[model samples]
Target chain A: MQPAHSNTVIEASKLGLTFQTSDGPVRALSDVDLSIGKGEFVSFIGPSGCGKTTFLRVIADLERPTSGSISINGMSPQQAREARAYGYVFQAAALFPWRTIENNVALPLEIMGISRDERKARIKRTLDLVNLSGFEKKYPWQLSGGMQQRASIARALAFDADLLLMDEPFGALDEIVRDHLNEQLLKLWGQTNKTICFVTHSIPEAVYLSTRIVVMSPRPGRVTDVIESTLPRERPLDIRESPEFLAIAARVRDGLRAGHSYDD
Target chain B: MDRFRDKIIPVTTLLAGLVVLWYVFAVIMNAPVQRDMDRRAGEDPRFSEFIGKTLAQAKPTLPAPHQVATNFFENTFTRKITSNRSLVYHAWVTLSSTLLGFAFGTVLGILIAVGIVHFIALDRSLMPWIIASQTIPILAIAPMVVVVFAAIGVTGLLPKALISTYLSFFPVAVGMVKGLRSPEILYLDLMHTYNASASQTFWKLRVPASVPYLFASMKVAVAASLVGAIVAELPTGAVAGIGAKLLAGAYYSQTIDIWSALVAGSVVAVLLVTLVGVAGRIVERSMGGRPA
Candidate 1:
């Protein structure tokens, strides 16, 4: 259990990312600042081509920001990794096709030199957490798209990393499945008490799930607004249909549009 | 269901027709010849004895099919692996070279594939040359490979194994290169995001992704290795091998011996290929979760 006093788990200040294409340098993100507290569910919502994904990548140390710095658990992203600071769930499941569901979840543990008996126990626990307990021996291909994604989430949880960075983890699912996953995700977040930094383009999704929503715009992308949701702590499916949720979602949409107008 | 049934009917009909035709032709062909030999056997003792030699010589062409069956059963029953003249002895000799060549070839192929995958320049320079290498007739090069290896003081199994390796490695190299590069762009980006080291990405992702391709290529390599070993043997005129038996049979007009040796070579190749297929299934089952 984390102490209440120091809730800050991730901090990024004036983070910028620039890629050198054949034509010239293209800035993907510019001067973005955000901090994620322990047990916070933060969503990065933006239009396409905005740096929401890039920002998540920066936090994950997938991409190095051109300027500014980010820290995880009071250490730089690299140092935090040495402490096993986080687990990343990609847009696609990225499950190793040659591995069974159990083995896929056991990958990070194997890398960390965990013993077989303990690894097996953790695998079962994580799979159970994702409601995938019975699918342990099945291959990734044998599962449906939604199930594969859930299994991937289970894999991220298998190592017990405190910070979970997700890049559009549910973007590919249909609406009905997406809503179900979102409700499950909120429950998972509440139960695990792990800080989650999720990236998505859906405004309602951000408003429904996040404690705070960071809205971004494209073309040398930068954050425009960070809205702290006023929804009650005990969030459920009913809250998504509430006036408060819709209003916050509309605000996120306006913030996204405002960032786009400013770019022009 | 109809499609499957239709596909099988033609094959079954053709096979049944061929078997009937074979028995009828065998009787028609052998009767006249057998009758003339029998007539000569009655005419004179020396001629009859000479006729017996001709009948034995001609046995391979018409072999009553039953004669070949009897020979096979007799050889298998008593000679076994320990006997010098046994089919098992020749098979073992062939199998050793085939297996050695396969191991050597597979390792070399994987290394070359890694080099190709890692370096673009190597891919450009080596890929075309590798493909071109296959176009060079194995028959044309067999004697040269044998002679060169002999000149280098390499003999016995090494020369034959090297020949097999030369033939077997190309498929594995090409197949693995394709397999290693098969990861999707999104997956690559995901690994990049994780800050995965190159070796980490390789073992965790690339190597596992290449399993199907590696096994598929092994089937081709095993067959090629058997061909290489037999070809290598032909050039060396090795004292103890099936190839030497084939050559001696040809020289002496012992056509039955030559045909039987051909059957032996084919049987060895089949067994090696089947072994690889079985191994591929085991690996695929263990790794990919179930057999196809």
Candidate 2:
């Protein structure tokens, strides 16, 4: 196992992706280079159609980048997938409606051949971590949207995966729900010590959650700016009122405008 | 009260209207007109009584109600399961074949559905043929199937069950295919992220997801199998089954007997369908297990 202090958990170079659509060969991404350090919370903030999701898909091996080499923990993304290196949460909660909250959380552990007793213990712990202990018996439809999403995060955490990939997981929630989830997510990261790569469109959310924010441009999407956060490690809800928070928010805005005119 | 008024009241009113119309026609239509024909036929002066008895035996349409009821009692209670003349024996013969056939068909349907879901070529090629197969009337080709199987020296339950299987499988196949594909794209991506293999995804997601659909389709399949078994018996000129009894009564102009046998067959079909529905509920509940 690599040391926790190792700076890079994911490395991508000269990554590109193209789709053969009816219109023509559409270049979805072009010449992307990025790295995520161990135990770091990196957020990809970009305009619509900026290929942020696509990049995440590539890293997860759900899609293969048309060009460039990428590795997760020194293995190819596909290899990493077989080894179950990371857990991914999507924009939607994506809970299996047929399964209750507990079963949904237990799914990955079940597949990974964990014994039943251990699986039960892990599921309870993870559900509690996401504040969903009482909801173990509830089906996805019975819960509020935010609760379903928290269950999804708990599912990702249950397998003890070292890396977590979240694609706008709270995008559909109300602002209040999103804020609560954001705080919980930070605590989850702190406790689990997992490297995270989150993709989103919210400027404040990106700036608030990320240790580093990678701003991306659209139309052959590419990274334009990489900003390291200057906020204190001990952040609370009141941090949003701080001048430092406002300054970083302003920097993210400038980066968004200067990199890509997202309103196309 | 409003919910009941909105949905049930209209339906009950319509059904009541139909029953009233039937009574009016029975009492009012062709009373004297049929008297002239009854006299011309010149059976007896008690012609009205004869018509009444026949109507009571077969139904309002032909023989009547009482005659058919009498025949059913005679065949089912007066005789026995081993008796060739007994409707109970014939019904048992038919039920056994139908039950076996339904089981075979359900298993085959699930296998084919799973295969089609997993393989692209099977999905493209097999599905069209399955749809087309149902359009071909069972009545048209039942004799040919019987003859072909008989020629090959396959006898007894096999031919009857094959026909039942043929009729029953289509509903299960269609239901299962839809169920297997019912998961949203996002859920599939979740499986992909978990690095779940195709088989793992199927057992944990697709198979469990398909349960409600499977049970629903099973009800249809069971009913279809009963229909198939009865139809299969017709082509064979079966001597010891309900279909044979109906055919014999028809040839002898025993209209009351024929009508009674048809009602008996319908009753059996309803019973079988009801059993399947109950079983489906049980299976669904069991597979769902104790909550989470």
Candidate 3:
């Protein structure tokens, strides 16, 4: 029973990861430090080779950090994971093609051994939250890509974990669908008040949705900058045109350019 | 209706062409025997007489299609089903062995696949041996299997089934292994995030994913099992089943009997494969997989 007022949800100190491949040992992340507070939407933004997704994976306990430490809710990532502390949405929807949308959403609940009636209630509620209520009986391939991703989000939200780790969940979508989903996601986040750690390569997306943006560089990946947003929590899609949003976007762009220069 | 038309036209054309070719070959092959018979009777037969005689030979090298079809119909329908002389009785004996062996082989294959997928040591050690087992021709081993089993007083269906099991299990083992490992790494990571036990992952993820592969392999395995069952009957000198019928026909130069038995065996194979396909479709649909 930890205190409810504690704001820190995830804290990483000097964390690093290196993968040993047939060619050589490749460092994916190095000397990273960050902390995400309760109910904060933190986005990790960088170029393709950057370890932003790796960092998210570390927090999810999908990949082990070779150095330093990361704690989720004051517990080791592994312990936190075992305790069902968070839900993850992959870059691809990654829904099981054999499962209908409703069954896919209900997967984690089934794994957690929830009773049938309760599982049904949570599935209905979460699908409604993602605006996917009637599409329950449809298989994943039958739905559009954006719909599939929303179902994936519904899957993540089904069990109602306190934290959500999303890795470029909408990256494959078209711009219109991406914008629509981003708006929906923000609304969902506001309503749920869950801490979200998102990884993406898009600057506008980072500036629009995040409370703070952590910019990272590739090749022995390390964080280059962390920018705090000054925008109000209740943001409209038009806020992308505001001078404040432009300023933060410019900073993220400059940090990205500076990260490229490190190779020289 | 268009789909049905698309399938029926080509198959019907090919079958008609095959029947025409069979009549031509039967005439050519039975000609020499007809010529010898005419000479012995001191009668110079006319071309029309020669053609008629060749088409209706008592035992041609390749029996005419109509002759074989007549034998097939008569043997299948005119005799009591329980009579040893009936093709239905022999086909039933062979089918029973095929089905039993297919069941045993499928279960064994799935178990082996599970072991190989779950244990790296088994994958390394058992996989090569499984592949090697298939290289020794079933024809060579069938007789030995029959002899050994007969020594142990295990005759008839069990020995034939053992050979069928041997031939059928390989495809299923290989396919199931491929299927069990088919889910991409990302899905496995998803399972890990859920803190799912290994058993949970296997049932909910691995088994369902492997189903399509299983059905494809079962089609191959069932056909092979039938071949194994027929071959196994060869060395036993058994008085029942398609293999025994073929042997008896060959002993008496009943080419019509041999050809009819071959056709009956083919019909059984098609029916068995179709049954497996229907089962696969139902299971896949019940599991919520999309139709082909």
Candidate 4:
């Protein structure tokens, strides 16, 4: 295996996607070039219509690019997807209401045809990682919104994939819960050492969790700037108030503001 | 216990009220014949005697509840099950056809639904035709179906089952289509990200998601199948089922027999529907679905 620091998990070049609707073609992403290295926590931050989520979708092979090529670990996204290279967490928990938490988390594993004993062990370990150890018997509706999202994360982590693609997984939660989850997520990253691509609209959230932030603009989305954070890997909630964290966040904000002029 | 009481009380009250109204209507409708008989006999029948005769007529226009019940009890219990006059025997005959047709209909419906959901062309082309089939009255077509089947030498239970299948498959097809498509795009994407095979996605996601819809449709389908079986029997002039009993009653003007056969048919329908409901509860619970 390649050394972790030298391994590149994702690579994209001049990628573009345009959706053809009855009204007309809507350009969701354009001219994007990005490379995410192993163990990197990258945040894609932009406005609502911006292609942050679309870019992640492209990486996950859920959506295809209209132009340019992208690869995960030197393979096409489709091939990589078929190989189960990454786990994806959506904005909504999206758990099957019919399935209990344990069963929901075990879904992908079951699809992969893993043995029951192995599935049980992984489920227990992953649920513990998300601090959801005892709530396995409860259904998604029985849990709080935050807890549901965590369960979804556990589902993604169950297979021990090296890469994770999260699309605003906590956007629906309140401030207090979001803050708590942000810290827990950072700790999760530290423990698993998985490369993460997160999409968010919040500046502090992007700054607090990411080792690097890619600022994007809407209307044929293009990458405006990519800012590398100097903040330590072990960041606390109060780190959001620190000067180094503020400096990185200010840069992301400025990049976003600069991209708005592209529409004019 | 409180919830059970809440449901039982209203149902009991409604049923009692219905029985009272039925008794009143029976007395009014049968009164004229009784009075004419009294005049012909040159005897002035008292009001009390008239009321009693109306409620106990041998061939009243609308059979009294007790008269129908007594006839039903005698036919069902006093006669051997093998007797041609036994309501129990006729009910069993009709019920066998109903069950066979219901199974065939459920299977056909699920297949059609899977096709419609999976193939866009089928959805666009076949769905409207399936719906239009239901618009033609079953009564108008039942005789033709029986005659056609007889010409082809397909007699007995199979023909009746085919008719039931025709009537019952529509609901299952429509419901299964809706259920298969009920999963959100996010869930579909989740499956895609897992790189699950098409069959895997269908069995794990679509089929399980469609369970509630399937059960709901089955309830309707079972009732429709029972009706289809009865209708199928009527046109074929079959002499072994409830439909045959009705035809014989009509020929002899045995209104009491007709009413008793009607009640027996209704009881069969209720039992079939209840069986489907109980089955749905068991499957849903085992699958960890919401409690009823």
Candidate RMSDs in Å, in order, are 6.0, 3.8, 2.0, 2.8
- What is the lDDT of every predicted structure here? 0.81, 0.85, 0.93, 0.93
Q: What would the per-residue lDDT of candidate 2 be over residues B76-153, giving only the tens digit for each residue?
A: 899966998788888888888899899999999999999999999999999989999999999987888889999999
Q: Report the C-alpha lDDT of model 4 over B90-189, residue by residue, as the tens digit.
A: 9999999999999999999999999999999999999999989999999889899888988999899998998899999999999999999988898899
lDDT by residue (B107-207, candidate 1, tens digit) is 99999999999998998899899999999988889889888978989889988888889999999998899888888877676555455678877888889
Ten residues in sequence with the least summed lDDT for candidate 2 chain B: B53-62
In the order shown, the candidates' DockQ scores are: 0.29, 0.48, 0.82, 0.72
DockQ of 3: 0.82
Best by DockQ: 3
Better of 1 and 2 by DockQ: 2
Instruction: Give me the runs in candidate 1 sitting further than 4 Å from their true place.
Output: A1-7, A261-264, B1-10, B13-92, B114-137, B148-154, B185-200, B240-242, B249-263
Order of all candidates by DockQ, from best down to worst?
A: 3, 4, 2, 1
Q: After superposing candidate 3, which stretches have Cα over 4 Å from the reference?
A: A1-5, A262-264
Q: Once superposed on the true structure, which residue ranges of model 2 sit more than 4 Å away at CA? A: A1-5, A262-264, B1-14, B23-33, B41-89, B286-292
Docking class of 3: high
Error of 4 at B242 (Å): 1.5
- Candidate of highest TM-score: 3
Residue lDDT tens for model 3, B1-292: 8876898888899999999998898999999888998899998988998988898888888889999999999999999999887899999999999999999999999999999999999999999999999999998999999999889998888999999999999999999999999999999999999999999999999999999999989999999999999999888898899999999999999999999999999999999999999999998888777677
